[model samples]
Target: MNILAIESSCDDTSASVLSGDRILSNVIASQSVHIKFGGVVPELASRAHQQTISQTVEQALEEAGISLSDLDAVAVTQGPGLMGSLLVGVCFTKGLALANDLPIIGVNHMDAHIYANFIEHQPEFPLISLTVSGGHTQLELVREPFDHEILGKTRDDAAGEAFDKIGKVLGLPYPAGPEIDKLSKQGDPDFHDFPQALLHEGLDFSFSGLKTSVLYYTQDQTNDFLEEHKADICASVSKAISEVLIKKLERAVDQTGVKTVVLSGGVSANSMLRAKTEEMANRKGLNWYAPHISYCTDNAAMIAITAKFMAQRGRYADLEMRPFASV
Candidate 1:
């Protein structure tokens, strides 16, 4: 079966064509307009999708050498993202499904992130997955492809959001997570000792205190000082954030009888986090699953792959399914 997927739940407007387990084509149109704002603006993002969705889907179909008529089904991200952006994709996808006379599947964005591992590796269920994205950070115990028991999640700000907010304080550009992650590699992580958030409650996590700590540390700083110390500060922030994530992931390893751990979501694109996760996973002798940098952010291949599973499970949504901005 050939599946065409759409993912416009955020700043990225993406589409991909998948036939069985192989992807025929994958295309992503990113919004460069958010750079000036230092982050995504929902209305602006939705508008940008409106302008690019058709062209992106067209390019994907062209690259795949297939028309919309060849698609067996249409899949789209349904929730856990910007409402306006999600609505744009959903409405367009619903219309396309109706025009093509194909079954439509609504996918959970977070679930799609985890299933990204399926794009490269086939680590079966009964394992622990740490999903870290711009908007979400959570741990899930997977007993089946569709059955996920959330083990831990951020109580306040998500790891990626924290990265961007801290970047704003340091005068970095918008969408600062990737930038900070890059600079952390060159700078000394131990240059500044940032506080790691320690919340001892079940398996849940919190990053608000750490966010506040970073904010307070810069309260007395001048603009020149911020500019001079930005790189080191970013490195310190990345270190602090990764420490919390690694510690909690380790806890999940000990709590669940599962040895496999999957690192996913947008923040999963970070080099420091990936290195730390890989190191800890190796040290503990656990099987690890993580998506490539391309799959780490919002993309349609993962959405298409996820829809393939949801389709097999008899999980199809009708015209009434609405988007959930938050998971």
Candidate 2:
């Protein structure tokens, strides 16, 4: 089956086309307006999606060498994102489906993240998925397709959100996770021992306390001190986050006795986290699956992949479906 997918759950507006199980094209338009604010502005994000979604969809179809008439279905991200942003994609997708008399599938944004691994790898069932992103962080137990159990989730700020917030404190640019990751490589992680919260707990994750610790640590430091030790600070914070994640993941593995692990979402792009996760998995003799960095972030390819699974199960959404801001 030929399917088209749209993802506008956040600042990026993306479109993808799939012919059966193979992806034909995936095009994304990222919003730069949030850079000045040091975070995503929901109003600006929705407006940008409104302006670019159609063009992005058209480009994706062109790149895929397919026409609208050839599409068998249209899938859209329907929840766990900004409401206005979700509406933009959902409305557009619904309209397209109505006009073409095709079926429409509403996909959960988080499930799409897990399905992203299928783009290049056949992740085994009964696996552990560490889904970390700007808006969410959680560990999921995947028993089968569409059968997921959320073992633990962030109590406050998500990993990617913490990265950006801490980056702002360090006077870095918007979407600071990548910058921090890059600079952390140049400095020592032991420069400062940041706090990692909820360690005694089995699988739950927490980063708010770590963020508060960084805030307090910076309050007594001079500007000169911060500037000189920026790399080390970044390294220290990155290490703290990675350590917490690894500890919890290991706990889940030991408790569940599941050796197959998958990681996805924007923060999964962090080089330090990826390396540490791989190291831990290897040390424990666990099978690990992580997608390419492109697939790690929000993309329509994963949405299409999820929709394909839903379609196979004879599950489809009616036109009355609504988008939600949270799971």
lDDT of each: 0.89, 0.93
Question: How much is 24 displaced in model 1, in angstroms?
Answer: 1.8
Instruction: Name the best candidate (by TM-score).
Output: 2
Candidate 2 segments whose C-alpha is farther than 4 A from its true place: none
Clashing pairs in model 1, backbone N/Cα/C closer than 3 A: 38-174
- What is candidate 2's lDDT per residue for 48-154, written digit by digit as tens? 99999999999999999999999999999999899999999999999999999999999999999998989989978889999999989999999999999999999
Give one digit per residue, the lDDT tens place, for model 1 in 1-327: 899999998999999998989888889999999999888889999999999999999999999998988998999999888999999999999999888898999999999999988988899678888899888999999898989899888888889888888888766787889889877877778878987766445667777787788899898788788777777788888989988888888898898878898889999989988899989989999988789888989999999999999988889998888999986
Residue 191 Cα positional deviation in candidate 1, in Å, after optimal superposition: 1.1
Cα deviation at 86, candidate 1, in Å, is 1.3
